[model samples]
Target: MKTSFDTFISEFQQTDNPDEKYTLIEQIISSLAIIPYGHKNLTKSEMIAHKVFVILRDYVIINQLRQKHAEDTSSQKVLLNVSLLFMNLCNNINETNITVFKSLFIHKPLIDELANCLHEISTHGKYLNDPSRLRSVSSLLIALQKIRKHNFTALEYSLIAPILFSVTQCLCSSYALDMIKSLERNFIQELDEVQMLFLYAMPLYVKWYWDYCDPEYFVKILRILLNDFTAWFTSCQPESYLQRSSQIDAMIRHLNYFLVRPTEFDSMNIFSEEFYDDYCKLVLHWSSILSSILACSSCTMNVKLAARTSVQILYNLTLHLNVLNFMKTIPSFILMLLKVTDLDHDEVQLNAYRCLGKIMIEADIKTMTKPSKIAAVYIAFLKDTIDDSKKTERFYSLLESLKSKFLSIVFFYD
Candidate 1:
């Protein structure tokens, strides 16, 4: 039986129309849909797969990057090539071909080279101020994102700075983040809540999967956004600035905006049956990180830092705490200061109560005069009450201490 290899190649070469090529590729892909398990032909499959991906990788703009370069936004060529190659490989092996796609990235020089190309995206955006090039860079980065299934490495972080600075400056992250979350809500199934959370960080998650994420990443961005808020507050009229603030009182307005919201999951529908059983265990590890931040917040004397950052400080503190979970930490954090290691009882009480007092109301005003005018005075008044009451008049002092706590609650809630 003579089989015509020319006939097969002829039909493929005839697909001159891009859409037709893609359609033919899809037909090839549909043939590869099967699940596999047990011992497998990884070596043979990997060898062919590597060659396929290597040929595909060749199409990846094979020039040493130069400064004035423009990023290629058209990934469909290589993307289609990989998809077609992947489907054929999968049909022969009886498994999804994601592992084969990943092997190309796992090869060291290739990873470094890919990262280097991405670095061009970063550099071009920064020095050139080319937003289109930046967008194209992101498109390529995102395709690698698909190949790696959104995974990354610590080394690629430098490549992110250009895109991050660009996107943060632009007004599109809000929309982009929401689109990512909507996809997470609908299609991201295999992940449990925790894996899903890593998935939810959107652009950031891409960095995280690659091991590029640092908790400080968010902290740095928060600081920049806070500065924007401060600058706007300083320049604009008081009523208008307050009304038009980007972050309310300098705290993250949406706690889980890019993370999981309550709707995509329910505690009753928790991904883990062990969640409730291990609730205390999870809190134990999380609280250690929380405690250190609260301590730093306590020791810092920068009044502007405290006044401006208080909302965010408390906002973060409350994050891991659902109503019940929140209550569990308070006793420890508060009671730590309340510790009777016999440090001056009155003095400790005065300091602890004072920290709690600021938790209620701290000035948001940028002007010195505003914090001093009754707004500042109200805060000082609470301090004085805590001080005097901690000393002599036991009955009056208790009453004053109670007053401060109640007053704080009123302002915080109102």
Candidate 2:
């Protein structure tokens, strides 16, 4: 009598016949571990294994709508099995630098079903959070990147966020293309107007840690997000949801990087304007983020850094423009930069003073009537700076000019 392994091979050879394909694969997979290798040469039997994996992957998609996979051989259970099976198959094929993954996964269009199968796997939060299972997903994404649109399938990360963010960050490293792919996927909502603009100027804020931790990889991903965000923001459909999303707020948080590394990105390559028109608008947005971020942190060191970075980006960019927004924005810009005093070290205070000086250079005290309460805060800060024993002569000098500007406008109203 022939063994079960022999029966599977006989059935597989008949695979060209559609009627026999499903049954042949089902029989082999149903008893995959049980097949006796008693004295058989397993290495020579790969053709049989490849055929089995291919059929199972296709089965889930063609039958996804089946009411029974929901209960009997549920799509849920089958999906979990497929995710695991695909990973193992890749590993098995990769034992010695083999191209089994490409041949089986990328070359075959139907295999994208694995990405969908993962959507079902993600539904069971308990299972997804399982250490072993989560690692399986990271592994799958990483391997997929080596082939094709693997990164394109990252929408699954958004579907499982809060945890997905934490997990992907945990999995991040120099070689983890999957984590980046997932991040790129999360930024895919370009059609949402507010989401797009905030996205433009966003990575500068929301992505600080990710960008600093691995700049080369992170920047590549960020640029992609920014390009998409900028395109969407410039299209100008004019939706009211602009205030609804934190995109603009998030951009303000990390405005420091742009100032310090202004040369890091080529303007023509990344931003649309050659000068500071949008950079000034960005300053306004960042000031809001810093104020929001500072309210949650009491550390003096942090407050100072946030303030200084805010001032620096605004100060430096404000100097480069020949545009007329200087008078339009100076009063509010100075007020925003003033709040960041706590984060500065000895040098930051000086750098910040220079930023104020740059803005003061273009002042028009005759225009931009800011509110009285807002003007009072600037007066109070200037007076306090003048009184401080630690004040650098240069800083105090810059303060005198700003104090003059503030009082010049305030008394005009008085």
Candidate 3:
């Protein structure tokens, strides 16, 4: 009366030997692979799937505990097989089996263990070129993606922090990229949502690991964020509105942190010259991206809001002396700010002009060759300010401050 599933579970539980457990897990994976998608019968199928998931989850937890003492090759093989089994189960998940799947795997202990396994595999240079590790990592990421899909709340900041750090570390290797690309090609065809999942979690990731991650790591993270933002902006999917906003906000706020130079009162700060240089380069790159977004005549109102927010951050950067000096080095960056001043959006134009005023105050008049052109832009901006009846008195005050600075420059030029 024993089904093959029952028999496999019995053998899997009885085996103390890793190799035997690995074989049984492989058999279980192979057997699960044949289960037809969307079968009508629920009771028997759910019970069987639940038992398999529990067995694999238990084995992974035990193996993880054992791994603390020593590295076992046999144990790693079994772990890879277990991950493969989880991937197979994830593929077969449906409304019928989803509850069972979430119940067994969405717990913090299991997620932490899986993250630990991924961290171990990803951080080791020896595993970089190993096909088994690649498969294991891909399977683990798919499993995590399923968990993320089913219960995003379960992946709170604490649980997800290590996973994000590990994945970022893994991405340093070309092998990991190949593995992720393979996953994208084989499983999820639309886009690399797995990578986007990481990017989406970036606000949390940076919050938790900012002090720990190196400047180069942050540079890499920012680059990925910008690239994803560009893609999302171009495609402009209706559903991805929140995603785009979150990414834009995260990038802008993260950049905002660099604008505030660390003072002697700040004991916990990790500010360094190298980090400053990286921030300067990122600001220049982000300026170019923002210019394109603002210049796009067809961009949405939401995109305009994002650009305005970014311009405000850029203006904030010009307030800091060191960052302002770095900003002054890039004349094209200055021109981008000036060009933004000509845009129709009031807040964006105001912020861009504020940024320009800051630059003009510190920068020598000769560096800005077109003094008349600059004066014309300021005059037009001041005229627009006077025409708006709803314009706050604060605007008038700021205009006068900038006006005096520009007048001094014009006098020197004359």
Candidate 4:
């Protein structure tokens, strides 16, 4: 007897009625759900399973071709159901079933079709009027992301950014949030080693959609993403170190907008009091991570140096904004800055001094005047840099300004 998957697809292909075809497609997907639960070990019985998926896969390609002219509701339903079935297989594939899942390779036409359908309906507001269509389209894209063998080229990945933009643009904030959660859920659960390339594509995706997404919703999405990234960074395997670092660097490049102009974001209620509260907490959290990395002796010199530089950048922003009260508690970061002040790289040294200067200008007189605190560093930094005039003017100017403030305070006290 043929496998249940084979039997269903055969009957599914015979049906010309869209409703009947949709029902059969649903049954086919329901039957495949057993693969993820480990009940169907397709690896051992790969031949039969491969046959089933190949037929199903080809059926999808043919219907996708037909779907172009399929304007009636019934035809739309059948085409959508078939598309969902393919996505379901992608999402539900596991180690045991991956061999069978590989049948989806080279389905670029079908992939493009699904993306186009999603964007066309979404851009035109079809999904908005019918919530189910929105969910189905979103679900289809989420599912397609799971197919490891269908690696998207950079050009194809670029197509994804606009689809994401269109979807988020047309949906309400609540539904947009739902769609984001589904995409994230699939990224977390459905992706495996072979599928990790998509992770690199994500930063580009976020960058493209950043300006288009509603600030309110984007910030929430960003927070969740930040938390996930931190967790990934902290527990990451060695193999992923470079990829994770690149992703973090790309993401921070965009986050600078919020860090640089909190007021602009606040005007839109993007940085409202509630978000600012969360913002302060997240800054502190990342501060601790950077400090730990800087302090860890076993870490590579390059990594430690990078972390030190990031600390300077973070403190410079926080101190200048004066938004987070907890910045004062992280005094250890001051010494890290002083240590990097002696580095060979001019920009790094400049950033270190700038950060220290900000901290000193913001510190209370007592903190500034302590023997080993700003006073001692200020004197040494100024003395050590007396001969280096290459862009050293800015450093001296900042130092002189801070010293003047500190001296005025002391003269008043005396």
Candidate 5:
């Protein structure tokens, strides 16, 4: 079986015709898939699998290099098949055979090939319609990521820098849309696999290469995800209907990571007008997410509380970002907060009221021409919450500040 597999690999690799090569490779893969692993303490099957993996890896590497520079569409398709085969073997091959797989070569070239392929698919035009090609590329990267978990090195860490840079570009590119569409064909639309891949992989990149956590990388990754999150936000079925999904959870995890690891990411020059403006946009986008989550009555109180906390955190981070415009732009913002203000959670209520205060002040200034009517509108909106016995004293104080700051001349007799 081992010798026949080796013979099969040789024939598959040596064939000049792409059609025959693909056919031969498919047969080889089929045969390898069904080979029982238990024969003679699994030695025979493991040996055959190991040999097949080595051959697959070598062929994959060779073809990846060819694919890297190949201008001919035929060469590109053949190379793509090699990647697909690599993914198949990686998925089907057992972990025990990995010991044999490790002896073949250094991971750097494979890593480089994987990153370059991703970058290629992202930057090139022809590969856009090829779902098989894109999935094969993503699968190779994910397989590498999995292997790196148990066998890491400085070289591996070094390679991830470029991998992440490419990934960042990949996410930013128009190809990312294709990648998302391809993944959705296979997975759920709401929690897109490609987006989830980046969301998970970027943090892992940070974990491995902490020194690479500069502001440029930070801003690029954040903007890419912010754009994706916005897309998800607009297209997502309301949270009420879908059971808990990764869409919201993924964004929350992303925010949670940044919030917890501030020393790594917080040193951006907030004073720069451009940076500050971009930051405000990012924060406001995040605020929209929180507002959406809060508005969903089906979401658990815990999730709502979490969303409120995230809002509070954003408010704290961007005290200077004109929080009022953020609130106003997000149509659900004020209403979401009002709903939360009467809730039993003190922290959530306080945060909601505080956001309300910002909105009132902004409303007063923005509607200065019609300040009285605007203030009346806001007062009328808050009248129910104020009437609630659960309202905290500080909540009233926040409302009073809203009045003083927005409508000081008009005294409230109550």
Candidate 6:
């Protein structure tokens, strides 16, 4: 079997005709797809699989490079086949063959090629419209995700930086947003697998390459997702739902990372006038969504979780004075936060109160139009603190502290 596979690979490499090469690759894929890794001929099968992987890796690297510089439509079918072959190999990997598979598939050059292929598909016009592009992307992402399930050395993490950057760039591209919209339109209330895989891959990449990734790119992608969420919330379709709770969770996770790494995110121009305006729009949309969700008596836990995350993101944004200033200008935003403070969820209420405190603490009472509303929210919270018999002593202490902190500002304004 080894000899036969070696001969096949040689024939594949020596072929000058693209058609012949494509046919040869398909044959190889078929042969490797059936290899019984659990059978008694495991050693022979492993040898054959290893040889085939080496050839496929080389083919992917070379063709990906070619596709990068030129619009090679003819190669698309072959690349798709190769990606599917990789996915098959990944699917068959187990503890016994893990080392062998990783050795063959975890090459840095091959990873770079995969990343470049995705980047090209996202940026190039012809590739964007190709019917097989999404499938190819999905296959590649599956294989990459499988490989990434194993632990990597520091050097390997360094090698995968290109992949992370490419994925981020692709996610932030206009093409990705358009593709998501198209999928939503076609599927109507379900996110496509390709979109979900992209979302899944993002946090893993961020986790592995946070130090290397640009904060601006993260912000750009987050803004795109927020806009999508806003649209889903405000769309005319009564049956349309915000089925992207996972997306909201992702946003919250990434925002939490940004908050902890203040040196990396807080010091940047992420809060410039342009970003501030974008965030203002996001907050207004989020406010409206939160108001609607609060009004619904039968809102699901997922929707409420999403609403809480939106407020958490808003609280994180308030760490910057510019955002706080903008929040103060929007009465709907203040009212939404105040309504959130009345929610039963402790974490949600904490974030809401934090947001309100931030916005009002630095607020100019002389220019403020809704100081009365802010005062009312604090007074209501105080009343709740006084009237609730189930409140613990510790809870009362925390509320009393918050009351002192907020009442001082209210009296100063009065």
Q: Candidate 1: which stretches are off by over 4 Å? A: 1-50, 62-96, 117-136, 144-202, 205-207, 210-213, 225-414
| Model 6 Cα lDDT, one tens digit per residue, 183-239 | 443113444545544444444445444555666776677667545543543343322
Lowest-lDDT window of 10 residues in candidate 3? 259-268
Winner by lDDT: 6
* Model 5: residue 292 alpha-carbon error in angstroms: 12
Task: Choose 1 or 4, whichever is better by TM-score.
Answer: 4
Candidate 5, residue 395: the lDDT equals: 45
**How good is model 2 by TM-score?**
0.28
lDDT by residue (334-382, candidate 1, tens digit) is 4442231113233333433433443332342121121222233345545
**After superposition, candidate 5 runs with Cα above 4 Å error:** 1-4, 7-20, 33-49, 60-65, 68-109, 121-126, 159-161, 172-215, 227-238, 244-414
Global lDDT scores for all candidate models: 0.35, 0.40, 0.53, 0.46, 0.51, 0.59
Over 1-414, each residue of candidate 4 has an lDDT whose tens digit, in order, gives 246756776787688886686577656655655455333343344633555556545554446433534445654454455555555545456555554454453355555554565455534533344433433454454554454233344654554555555434433233333333333321113332112212223233333334444566555544544344433333433322223344344334333333323232234344434445444555555555555555555546566456554654464345334443455457675776566555445455555555554555535444533334334445555676675543254355555445445445533444
Measure candidate 4: CA RMSD: 15.8
TM-score top scorer:
6
What local lDDT does model 1 show for residue 360? 30
Model 2 regions more than 4 Å off = 1-224, 227-281, 292-299, 319-330, 338-344, 362-414
**In model 2, what lDDT does residue 40 have?**
40
Q: Count of backbone clashes for each model?
A: 3, 9, 0, 0, 0, 0
Candidate 3, residues 1-414, lDDT tens digits: the string is: 137767887887788997787678767766655665333432334563557667777766445433543366655666667776666556655545666666665566665665675566555544434444445555666665554443334335355566656656654444334333332212112333333333323233343344344555555543433333333333333233223545345433542442232221122233433345545654565576576665666656766676786687566555445677888787677767766765567777667756776676545545665567555655666776675533433356455446546556664675
Query: Which scores greater on TM-score, model 2 or model 6?
Result: 6
lDDT of 3 at 74: 59
* Preferred candidate (lDDT higher): 5 or 6: 6
